[model samples]
Target: MGQFIISVGREYGSGGHYIASILAERFNVPMYDRNMLDQLAERNGIDAENLYKHEEMKRQGLHRTVRGHSSSVQDSIAQLQFNFIREKAESGESFVVVGRCAENVLRDNPALISIFVRGEEDAKVERISRLYKLNRIEAKAKMFRHDKKRKAYHNYYSKMKWGDSRGYDFCVNSSLMGVEATAEALYSMLSTYLKSKEQ
Candidate 1:
């Protein structure tokens, strides 16, 4: 088996993190998420807290940028993160990365499997409310806010539209069978697809 990569893009409150975890475990590969940014910052002498605070979302014009840089701090950090993702792929390793525009970064890799996970509005609200102990209205608002940020961040950096089915190998609705089943189904589909590719 050659190096394989799975880049998961998910909506907020859609159990994307959990689904990515399940896929990583099933594939027996390491998964990279926001924490990877912290590792990158530590290794490169960048401020991890500042990197995380503005991750995935761009800074507004009024906000102060990272010290000593004329450009947006988020843009610089995003480039570093993209480089890290490419280095990992070039190392001939199989891994999963959630968010961070990884799908676009590795779009040229033949073994890359990009996925976007979304769910029904009501389902997302229910999940968020339960997980955060927030009321349904609050959960819905939070979901909208997060989705907007994610969309903006992705659109700002990538040529493809965020969360669009055409941009991904698979776009699944987790509300139908929940996270566990969705992961399992995707795992099976990927397994078969890889086998077909081998043939």
Candidate 2:
């Protein structure tokens, strides 16, 4: 087949980023995550660390825009990132992009394969707790906060709902079989998909 992109959208603490990384390794392609912001920052002379810290923050007193109008700094940065993602797609590179509304940004491309990952609430909380050294209650709270921000950010930037199964070509629950197994299953499915495309 030709160049294709794996665009993954996921809920907080779902191991979606880890899954995306595995798929990228299996496919021997680059994986784009929040690090895209660093590159964008460098290119545009922005502060990378500050951008990372505030990338998903919502600004008060600002309304969403259409017709190329951006009323907030976050919106401007998002537009720049979207343009960067489109450029990467146009460059004929096969890669996996995690979040940043990549599913919608590359929606029109035939090479796009969008995936959404979610997990059971308990699983998410546990994962977050272990990863960040927080207690279960704190982890649950953090997860909710992150998910809320993600939902808002994605909803504001894309036409589709974040983590909505209807918006993705494949939606998987990482909790059902754990993260590694989930990644393996997805990789197998993608392998079959690639073969079908070749035929």
Candidate 3:
């Protein structure tokens, strides 16, 4: 089997993480998301809590976070994550990585597949509300805030714009087909993508 690195970019509450998990199972490959931070902390001797506090969402705007931390912290963490991503890709294993601009890190890999997953506004709001146990209004506000942060972080780190269809090889409206079906769709498309590479 060919080694493929699948990078998933997504909107808040789009079920991107779940879909990536399913794909990992289908491919029998490891998946990384929040766990990336844990791995980084363990390997680099950084504090896990600090990494969590500054993860993709909060790293973009230093002034907006707690006082005394500068953009330097964000830069170091981002660079570490990118280095880890490249290390994983260099190992030449098939893996599904969610967010943290994995696509940007692995763009030069021949077997890389970048996907952006999104959902309808109302559906995403409902999904987030249920998952986080928040009311619909609160869910919408939370989702909006997260989307803004993610977009800012992604754009700040990568040459491509976040959520831009042109930036990815494929895009999925996960809500339209649901998580399982969306996973199947990605699997099928990835099969074709791999075969085309061989030809």
Model 1 C-alpha lDDT per residue in residues 88-179, reported as the tens digit of each score: 99999999999988989999988789999999999999999999999998999999999999999998878899998888999999999998
Error of 2 at 138 (Å): 0.4
Where model 2 places Cα greater than 4 Å from the true spot, the runs are 63-67
Which regions of candidate 1 are displaced past 4 Å? 62-70
Cα lDDT, all candidates: 0.90, 0.89, 0.87
Q: Which pairs, if any, clash in model 2? A: none
Residue 98 lDDT, candidate 3, scale 0-100: 94
| Model 2 Cα shift for residue 181 (angstroms) | 0.5
Candidate 1, residue 24: lDDT: 94
Tens-digit per-residue lDDT, 33-119, candidate 3: 889899989988878999888788535443433363345677668777888889888988789999999988888888789999999
Summarize candidate 2's per-residue lDDT along 27-52 as a digit string, tens digits: 99999888898898899898898678
Candidate numbers sorted by lDDT from highest down = 1, 2, 3
Question: Which whole-number lDDT from 0 to 100 does residue 156 have in model 3?
Answer: 88
